[model samples]
Target: MIDWLNSTALTVFGVGTTWAEVLGFVTGLLNVWLLIRQHVLNWPLGILNVLLLMVVFGTAGLYADMGLQVVYVILGLYGWWAWLYGGAGRSELVVRTTTRAEWLGLAVAGVLLTGGLWLFLDRMTGSTVPLADALTTALSLLATYGQTRKLVESWWLWIAGDLIYIPLYGYKDLWLTAILYVAFLTLCVLGLRAWRKAIG
Candidate 1:
């Protein structure tokens, strides 16, 4: 069964379907769905998704992305705890808008991180899409942090990252992953609206 699934190639997209990719895709979908509903389960599901994708990205030569998954695991754990206890008086976290100062700080951090990763990948690795990979990684880190804080602006950062990720994943021939990002883009829009309503 595993071999059959791993060897099966989708004729339409010419991308081979693997068990890791399938698992990653399924968990990725569930993670975003839970996130849209603001369920605490999203964090645990996200941890599984990232672990599965680590294999996918590692094979596809997306070193930065593979590394990003490691970060996602740590962030996922943090988010799980934060959502349950990082609120006022150890209550559930609530949706909120990012302050101007917070936004400025995050923007600066993202720029510096992107630049640093770009340089590292360019000099130290054989990454095919270093800049795009670095940019998405940096934005995703910020987005995940925002999500942990239950900030509505996290969806905005995710929207931006997904826009870049779709084409980049496609270029790497990870068609299913690219399609997942398209779904992510849609979910980001929905999540933004949902969080806004919650905040108001």
Candidate 2:
């Protein structure tokens, strides 16, 4: 498993892309596509996406992002059940907007969590891009949590995170991963629109 995670699958432009990255790319795209359509299968695919990404990020010394994937594992399990039985009277979840209180809370948490994670990842580890990693880590948690609850704001959070993530992954020389985030950014826009329409 470790050997395969570290094995190069192919090259993009000129950089050798690892098998973990190659597979994460496929699963990540399908996971988000399913989420946009409110498919129950998104959760399971999301679990697979994060597992593969955990390897990719860890190899890059992106400890925060690697840790974020671990958290996603837990969230993925909860999200799976939530989607099916988390609504009122244990029904399928419906699309909804974040309440004002939830919005304010998420804003405050994103800021604080980024600051704290930046400090920890910088001081405690060898992460070269602690600030960017921390920022995306915070947004990712917020987005994933909101998505589990079927909140419309989740797609907004994903778009915000991807805008930061594209450059971060590229600067790290993870070309294929960077390109995947580009697609994710586009998918997030479509997701936001689709979810908004669902609420209406």
Best-performing candidate as measured by TM-score: 2
Model 2, 1-200: lDDT tens per residue?
Answer: 97888899999979999999999999999999999999999999999999999999999999999999999999999999999999999998899989999999999999999999999999999999999999999999999999999999899899999999999999999999999999999999999999999998
Q: Residues 86-143, candidate 1, lDDT per residue (tens digit)?
A: 9999999999999999999999999999999999999999998889999999999999
Residue 6 shift from truth in candidate 2, angstroms: 1.4
List pairs with backbone clashes in candidate 2: none
Question: Of the candidates shown, which would achieve the greatest lDDT relative to the real structure?
Answer: 2
Per-model tally of clashing residue pairs: 0, 0
